[model samples]
Target: MLSDPSRKYRPFPQVNLPDRQWPSRTITQAPRWLSTDLRDGNQALIDPMGAEKKQRFFDLLVKVGIKEIEVGFPSAGATEFDFISGLVRTGRVPDDVMVQVLTQSRKDLIDTSFESLRGARAAIVHLYNAVSPAWRQIVFNMTMPEIKQIAIEGAKLLRDNAAAQPDTDWHFEYSPETFSTAELDFSLEVCSAVMDILKPTPDHPIIFNLPATVEAAMPNIYADQIEYFGRNIPNRDSVIISLHTHNDRGTGVAATELGLLAGADRVEGCLFGNGERTGNVDLVTVALNMYTQGLSPGLDFSDIDEVIKTVEYCNQLPVHPRHPYAGELVFTAFSGSHQDAIKKGFAAQAQRNDELWQVPYLPIDPADLGQSYEAVIRVNSQSGKGGVAWVLEQDHGLKLPKKMQANFSSTVQELSDSTGRELTSTDIWESFEKRYHLKGDGRFRLIDFQESQSPKQQDERIFAGKIRIDGVEQSVSGRGNGLISSLANALESALGGQLDIIDYSEHAIGHGTDARAAAYVECRVGDGPVLFGVGISRDVATASVRAILSAANGA
Candidate 1:
């Protein structure tokens, strides 16, 4: 047994929101989405995105319906400042879009940020400062009043800078950077002081962005904090609340959703949650979540593959295959039960004409994101008959019967087990052709065939064929109730063996005059082991005769 490290680490205290209203709340619509891919996501990449890459990413964000984007932190470096200036000078920012630039709560940084936005049509100047007790005591060694004053001074500078830029429209935003780890009442107090300095009204409301900068607590606790702040913050009618959550606790998406229910009006994050440390909240996941619930998320990810390609190219990071909605295998089924359920679910869906998606093991239709059915049902050693039949039907247009599916699945399983690897549709089709389609030459080969009905009894039939048995050519004929039974008799007589046809089936392999008929035969010889065979020909009767001979040889 091991003792807990209580002395070294303490649990984060929960928010004291006894009357929290988030539990009864539900998200009925999409929030205003702001992407931070260029600023936060670009900074976290080992190789930061270049100017050209940033422009490409900006275009992709616009295509995906992101109206607000944090383009860069201009005061950080020349490259960042130039990137911001380039977008402004190039006329890359759309008229409906508002590009935002971030800065620290310092005079030099704020002034530099304004300088970068000098030629832009309009922009949001986001100012932030650390207000947590830990940051104040450990990093700055400042008292509560000192930290609050830093925010107020930054607000005054933003107001003065906007007053100076009369030709351009300016929107102001402020963040208590690590709001999740700060005292709730004190954080509200600092934000109120900034509001007093800015004096924002409903007509031109300022955005008060609360960030889960560290994510030191549970998602519900963060939600509780957001709800409390929304209820108690001064000038509530004159402010817009936004959330910026990080994923250090692996629950940033959950926190953001709950924060929306807690009455936040906007969200700020990056694609695939790419950011510093454990990264930011994944905006793609949040938006698509709303899409699945019948609420338009106001974003277009209908072609998610294109989004992944662009993001990976710009960030030089491979999206994990297990990432929700945008991954390579998000809609794939590998387990036996999962494959079976998916197969039956598709079948049931085909019989209906409704638009409601009810497939098992899939919350949303893969086709909605531009994925194909071939990628959904895959085959491996652990796969079942349903998976094998699904592959055959999708790839080769062969809808195998239930018993044939089980029989063929065993063959596939044996091959997969021997090689210890997954099998492709081509591999399964090849195996089937090799094992069953012995039409030309075998122990018993059918060269030609003919059929006739009795004059007195129309149901009575006769089959005749020219075949070779053990390299000897012979002619044989037999009478039975149907064509397949008559063919079985002819094959048995020609080969001098007792052929008992156990089962048989036939279907057209293609369409129109170019189509060929395929026939499957299962038979046993003198109580020996049962074997299966396949045949194809332009004539259905001829294909049946060939199938009988192949099964006789196989037995």
Candidate 2:
């Protein structure tokens, strides 16, 4: 039913190298991370961040342990210039962190950028120029030689500017802006020319950032381009390969990951993947991906909720609820089967006491990022018995037996189906109390009771109580092994019905002196169907007795 567009577009050519090495490579360590939230992410906003918000975001980046950050494009305007100048003047730029400023390949913009960075302890002067065939032919209407010369002249200007600022330590970075779509040989030529002008050594390395400016091709193509450049570019030992991927294709994270495998040494991205168009690759996801692999990403996302709040406040945009790791419902499971498996996984984890996280359906432990188990299993029409039991056990400390769980699950599912919505933990508990725990006027109700153990029959216990049936009070007595059994015997004799206990479970439901015990009982009367009931009281014995009466009333 879909229109084919094969005639309109050609497939992107694969790398010519038959022995591609990136496919077998793995990321074993953390790369140098550079956050461009203030520059790239801010620029993408409809209402760009103000000075206060920019400052707050910058501090958050530092707190997240990023040693290098592209703070702003100083030549863009007054606000950009002022934010950079303020960081320099106020000594806000930490000594250990390097603040980077973006600039075009123009001499004037490079000059203004240096002026904004003056008095800073250290900074990276990031210079970029468009170098793709499409850009060269359409935007500049120039040849490859002319475009290469522009980058060389920009490198010369950067050198002169850094020389002028003798008081600050300066590092250099260059990006072939449309490297993803640029010819491999041409991209290499331009980058090599800049490196030749910069004369960078191992101790004083230059960062050659390759940006997927528009993401014209698939992610694997970008990885091939990066690998080819890393393998062929001259003075490779003196250069640091970096990736700056965009999400136009919605595979920026995958592209960056593959690119990293292709020998890239650094990453340039924004938190939550904020950038122009489809946005940049999400650094949080990429870094945390490393964290889950047992590699220390060297970033602190322990309090991810705080991170989300700060980002949302500054960006004035709510993060998607399904966003990886940071979303409100990322750890939640609504499917019946998934919830059942997760419930069993948690139980297994508790007993195993193993340090490694192996919960079903959850890739990483939610607790590792400050999330709790309370929201892991949510109840809806689609949920099953395990999810209902998990909610009660985790949130309200009521561990229902297997049969009782099935009973409560049906109650929850019917409520959710009737309401056509999901149920919260509170909703589940409210439904449970109404259906099972509520005292009702029924066939029989227990009055005050007495229990005694006979010395002659050590195992037998005698129970006697006043019962009100059909508005009349009657004295009843029966003997059995336990309070619940004796009470059931007395009730069966008076009501003339067979009493059979199917299942039972009990647990403490609160804390301290105010704590109460909750008991669940499943029973059948004569040939009647099975019924479930619950009771709560200060004493476990009383709670069990109440559960029997509740079940009888329901029957």
What's the distance in Å from true for residue 451, model 2? 46
Against the unseen true structure, what C-alpha lDDT does each candidate score? 0.84, 0.85
| Candidate 1 local distance difference test against the native | 0.84
Clashing pairs in 1: none
TM-score per prediction, in order, is: 0.68, 0.68
> Once superposed on the true structure, which residue ranges of model 1 sit more than 4 Å away at CA?
376-555
**TM-score computed on alpha carbons, candidate 2:** 0.68
lDDT of 2: 0.85
Error of 2 at 82 (Å): 0.6
User: Best candidate, lDDT-wise?
Assistant: 2
lDDT of 2 by residue, 329-426 (tens): 78888898988998898888889956888889888888888786564322221335555565567567777776777777788879968986445667
- Candidate 1 colliding pairs, count: 0
